[model samples]
Target: MTTAPPISPRLLKGALIGVDLFNPLASIIVFQYNPDTMTRRLEPRSMTGADGDRGEAYRLSGAPKETITLSVEIDAADQLADVNPVAVASGVGPSLAALEMLLYPKSLAVIANAAIAAVGGIEILPTSGPMVLFVWGPSRVLPVRVGAMTITEDAFDTLLNPTRAKVELTLHVMSYNDLALTSPGNALFTVHQITKEVLATANIFNSAQNLGTALQL
Candidate 1:
């Protein structure tokens, strides 16, 4: 008798994608293991009654400000066991560096600014890093800025290279109001909102159907 092969469920990994504003360069850091839990908070942008305008109390200025906090764990035990060259050599240093670089200005830009300053030039503009997108899933991909990060190195290899670490990240969602109208981040945020609305509508429809069945109406 022939037996069917066992089916394996597909798993998705969350990632952070950084796209340069003026160049074709991009950085994608896929999480090794998905976080166990993610915390999200939203603050509404509604008009306040303190303005003495009762009519404007129900008005909203823009999309709510949203923030997400998650803790990601990184470990090199598996790689080290398999004798991976990079892991054996530097442990998780490269992985840690990749995450840390999200908040850093480009080295070339920093050098150029310093050169200009050395020449007694003023009015040098500050450098901005690439725009980062926090992608939890298809429906949850949104532009975000790294508000804060805390890294804890749990273990190290013989060379003092970190073998295990946990990174706690606070991401501030960038809504349309926070980005330029012509920028890609703005477009992405608009699509994200539309997707959310569509999902909410679907949820309501399902709930109505269940309610009708329950009431036999």
Candidate 2:
């Protein structure tokens, strides 16, 4: 009898996808490697006491404010070892640039705004970048804004291109209150919260079953 080889489990990679607010299919950027660890913090939006109203003590204003922090690692060593042309030339510079661009306003938009200002246009609205979605897993996809980032380049090539780097990113989760009612982000957040509620219900059912078994009820 021939023995079959064991199959390895497939793992999904987390990613930060950028979609144009006006054109959804515009652009996307996937992380090179998944972060080893992630930290999340939540602050509840409690409407406890407004003008000493004790009746509203248990009321909530909206969804809790959430913040996530992760450190992404980028390395060009493997690709360079394989003699990849792009890696040989840029040495991870392009990857770094892609992440950095998420925080920048488009140059064209900047130039257009400058022209409008010169021509005496009043109240040129601030430009908005693409909508960023942080996808950790199927159930954990969230619309988020990049609050801050710190990049540390550990290794560099002879051409001064970064060969290896670590980027610490702080992301602020956007809730329904932060987005317009008709916006895609608002819809996503609503679905995310619904999913959480479903999971919580399932947990309650399982716990109740265990309790019944223990009590012989």
Candidate 3:
């Protein structure tokens, strides 16, 4: 008989590793752009009734936009554990300290400045209709919302769809290995004695900053 693999550091504070894609591939990424030089065309010559037709050329120069992509190496477990991160409000901040692929309990529409909007992004939640996780910043918290419909499974087909007990309601991020583990789902797995490692992290992005707080697995 084969034994199951031991879980990594114990499951802390209801956390899950998520990405739009499962089994996240560690990639080396960075988002940055050189200045953009724009040229304005001079206006066409037209008959001026009162004032001479005025036309001018102006140049706009600014940094281009790129989502910074960071690489995650599997062997550097020691370095990853040493990162001391800071916590911020649910909606505003980078999630360092530790690495998690998913985030949940989303908020409403996320408002970003013009620059933050230019890059590609993904929503971490299952119901946010796939958000955009751009490659532009350090470890950060990207807020999103999810529904139970997409993540849950219906049990025992019935006359009027009576198999509703298995409905999964909650948010989850894809694991570095494509796992949809979250709120009610975790309960399901644990209850069934699913011996898989809970790729779960703290529901709070900043919880990593306070090492003393352990997650509720």
Where is model 1 more than 4 Å wrong at Cα? Answer: 21-26, 49-52, 213-217
Candidate 3 accuracy as TM-score: 0.16
lDDT of each: 0.90, 0.88, 0.28
> What's the lDDT for residue 31 in model 1?
94
lDDT of 3 by residue, 56-133 (tens): 222222111112222221122232245422211111012221222133312233334323445855443234323323
Question: By how many angstroms RMSD does model 3 differ from the true structure?
Answer: 25.2
Better-scoring candidate (TM-score), 1 or 2: 1
Candidate 2, residues 167-193, lDDT tens digits: the string is 999999999989999989999999999
Measured against the true structure, the TM-scores of the candidates, in listed sequence, are 0.93, 0.91, 0.16
Residues 1-104 of candidate 1: C-alpha lDDT, one tens digit per residue:
99999998888999998887554344677899999999999999887757658877878989999999999999999999999999999998888888888898
Instruction: Give the top-scoring candidate (TM-score).
Output: 1
Weakest lDDT window of 10 consecutive positions for candidate 2: 21-30
Compared with the true structure, the alpha-carbon lDDT of candidate 3 equals 0.28
Better of 1 and 3 by TM-score: 1
Backbone clash total for model 1 is 0
